[model samples]
Target: MRGLGDHLTIGERIAFYRKRRGYTQEVPAGLVGRSTDWLAKAESGRRRPPRVDMLAELARVLRVPLGDLLGQSVLLEDDNQLDDVPAVVMR
Candidate 1:
């Protein structure tokens, strides 16, 4: 099966994870100290990806590891699973 990280834009990836984690735009935006409109613009590709510093906070709010949020290879300690997920490079 194809992973969520495949061939998706940064905005799309963010939206995907956000939805997978069961968070509305308002919930994560508040947790990450961003406005709902900012998250909407980001998810819609109207704005750039969040800053690097904010990525960690976003991951935290979304209940995923930083690597997962960044779409990088993440090592799962419990099962020793390694996922080679492609990252969406923000311009």
Candidate 2:
């Protein structure tokens, strides 16, 4: 079976937020006092979820609500089934 890692691609979502906020990995890394390579890993999902502090800093630097970064909207209302899941989404 595929590992849990294969099923979760928060990196893509993180990349989306990063681009929407007009930041490259380097810029946000500078703001959050982490190395650019570290940021790259996080964006690529090679690293697990960043610390809450880092997430907050990234959200502020990107000019998006923290909830957006955290995906709060989907957390409560949906199963968040992976795209590969056979189930369908319902309203």
Candidate 3:
């Protein structure tokens, strides 16, 4: 499946990445220390997005950069390239 559009809400982004990575709700939910029902609600926009700390964990588990899930522009650089962009610290 295609990735989520730039205009999608956070909930949609989460669901999109989850599906793209071929993970069922139970898998990611458990990995992120959340219940499958909570994940379902979050994906459907029935619940608020995960907390910032949880967001990082989600990104790690989903194998996506945090910026992608957070709807921010991500800069990809090789090991030899130095990234000049300011880092966003999710607190």
Candidate of highest lDDT? 3
lDDT of 3 at 14: 84
Candidate 1: list runs displaced more than 4 Å: 74-89
What order do candidates take by TM-score, descending? 3, 1, 2
* lDDT, candidate 2, 12-75, per-residue tens: 5567777767777788788878898888888786777676666768767876655555554322
* Candidate 3 wrong stretches, greater than 4 Å: 1-4, 74-91
Q: Model 1: how far is 8 from its true place, Å?
A: 1.2
Give per-model TM-scores.
Answer: 0.73, 0.63, 0.75
Kindly list the per-residue Cα lDDT of model 1 for residues 9-76, writing each as its tens digit: 55676788898878889999998888999989988889888775687688778776666656565556
Please state the error at residue 90 of candidate 2 in Å. 27
After superposition, the stretches of candidate 2 with alpha carbons farther than 4 Å from their true spots are 1-9, 74-91
| C-alpha local distance difference test of each model | 0.73, 0.61, 0.76
lDDT of 2: 0.61
Worst 10 residues of 1 by lDDT: 80-89
Clashing pairs in 3: none
Please provide the root mean square deviation of candidate 3 (C-alpha atoms, Å).
4.3
